[model samples]
Target: MIAAGTASMGRAATPGPSRWPRAIVRLRLALRSSEAAARGGGGGRWAACFRPAPVAGAAAAAVKEAKGERSAEVEVEPARGGGEDVWSARADAEVAQGGGFPEHLVVMVNGLVGSADDWKFAAEQFVRRMPDKVIVHRSQCNSATQTFDGVDLMGERLANEVLSVVKQRSGVKKISFVAHSLGGLVARYAIGRLYEPNNRRASSAGKSRDDVEHLEGLIAGLEPMNFITFASPHLGSSGNKQARFLLLFYEHMTFKSLPFLCGLPFLERRASETAHLIVGRTGKHLFLTDNDDGRRPLLLRMVDDSGDLQFRSALRSFKRRVAYANANFDHMVGWRTSSIRRQHELPKHRLLVRDEKYPHIVYVEKEVTNNRDTEARADLYDPEEEMIRGLTQVPWERVDVSFQKSTQRLVAHNTIQVKSYWLNSDGADVINHMMDHFIV
Candidate 1:
């Protein structure tokens, strides 16, 4: 094992602005966590580090050479988010020609440490079924946002890109969204902020006609008729009491936890209350309130005990005040503060609901819905090879829970399992369900 002292520090060749270090650190920690989980314990604690595949890039080169045409039917474009201002850049005609981007416009957002390649199979399905639609990747994964200007903050930047993509696509009346993990937050922030009159007051405050037109264009862009997220922490969950407990431990233990959240483009993504009010089962916001002040003791103890990260400590204090004293939310995000329309029952239109009745309520209806049953497996994906291919077209097309009619009702957190099953299985039913909604 390498000594902690042996670690060397040099500036990142390209340090992103917010949570730049946090993303890198989280990326490392996630790798370590994956390894630790994989090891299942031996005499030594081996950290599983799934460094990016070296051979994959080489293989891409080899395929390029063999094809001889030097062109690919499927173009793997870089994701754009956290601000490099590339989202507005139009898809090239070659990439736009014929079958490419032929259907209704689909804007895909990825989870943390994920990339466009992540959407590979789903994109292929969309391309085959609805060949005219353009599915643009939200590039937040590419910059990792630590040093980049626009990429910082979870949902804000992501929302902007989504708007831009929808507006740019010709004849696009309806827009669809598919996001995973924190990527959902990014989309949420964008969608929420776009409609906020407070956020759009600048338009009426004396601007040029051209500026006003651009503003209107941005605001009135394509309508978000359908939305889907994969295992997103929308109602932010750790899946179990153990995960919930560990999140508490991490908040008090790790310095890197809190600020990492605010870096996303999510609207109003303040750090302080994430763990306590959003994800915590007992916080004021969640359905489970057995421990109303559960997180308080942990935060106080962390500050009193051994040194904790300053940013984290500050967040603990901030979140405590905002959440405990005011809003009362947590890590998994609260339905009251999520990208959903709150209701006594699931909304008949938007499929992604802020569930109140079931465990892991976000899961899709498991039983087949009058369609041919072709998939038998729950999941066949290599989760390790994922994360890098952000808005992957991977067959992980989940069920289109965005049913026009709401006969099925899902518990809030149950979505995790539903999403997991689709992403893991890459089933045709899942793809077809999404397509059904998109075309409809």
Candidate 2:
């Protein structure tokens, strides 16, 4: 017993130094485990604070690499109204594109029951692709149910919102609009309100043709550039006879817009009668049923310059006007209305080609019309015909998109804009096409 006790004491005294190293190692491993657990949200609240923060540049690069996007670093700041502005740093933009920081303001408007988030993908793509030439602002003023308001009220709201944005960003010298669905109509109405002739009449008394063209003036005192719409009902949402006949047999249809009624005669007629009950004043406007104040429908009045609202002139001020329409499966908006064409004007299906770069872009047509040929016809009683004639006065580049072969064809309206990246990734090419062809 005495020998055993003495041996234990001897060993305890001699190996104390070695034992200390083992103890320290055990402690370190315990701490690491706790840290890992805390990171995984298992336990140990304070362990997260011990971790080092990732370097900003490295983190951003990692994200870009993971997403396979070569987009430059951008900053997003809250702007007036419910919108947010996206722009890259001047140094980064110049380094990436060898150009000055963007001076153009691109307003992105959302559609029915939509918010600023609807344009998130497109807005980001715009800033990423044209970092040196454009700042994208996603509009949120007339979002969600607010879109149910009549076009005039929404237009006024949008105009005020835009003016607020302009006042906040005095550095912006150019303006453009990118809208979807109902937002297109809202944008049109807003521009009409924002248009200033620069005393065009006073300056045109003795000016040359060239000089008069130059005096076309500005939108909100800023030079207008591209005005683009995606799946917008430019000719209103009333269904045409051809579309109704084609969709007459589809029984499992959903309520999207007027055209989504599957072209059934009874459904279309019933929808026209009760559209206002569902979407409020905006529905009335879309169906051409709003005859408030004993006047023609608001959509009809918007086709021409009425009183101070120079609707056509405002459109003419822009350098480019584009309409992106879904040829099929966009039940929400009819191709004819979205494309601003008559039944006979639609391009043949055989003409559609799949470009390697833009697989979904089926066709593109640029319509050029002489000013004399597009003079507003006041005598025309057919509202749809009048609108088609009125808007075609300014040349439009119509881009036809078809998801006819895609798994996501059913939601072509949302897909065309990549409204939600994960769900609508198939529409990415359309956005890429827009970015590739976008004018600075």
lDDT tens per residue, model 2, 1-440: 32343243235334455554553344344446444664575535433322223346644553342234634466778987658988766635475676555779999998877788888777776776676788888898997667768789999998998999888977677899999988999999999999878675333233344644564667877778889999888888775533232221121122221123332355466667655545567878987889999998999989888889989899988888999999998867789999998787899999999888899999999755534444446776667877888888889999999998775575577789877553455787898888777777
lDDT of 1 at 181: 46
Determine which window of 10 residues in candidate 2 has minimal summed lDDT: 248-257
Clashes of each: 87, 1
TM-score of each: 0.38, 0.74
For candidate 1, the per-residue lDDT at 309 reads: 19
Clashes of 2: 1
Model 2 spans > 4 angstroms off: 1-72, 90-101, 200-215, 241-267, 370-381
Q: How much is 359 displaced in model 2, in angstroms?
A: 0.6
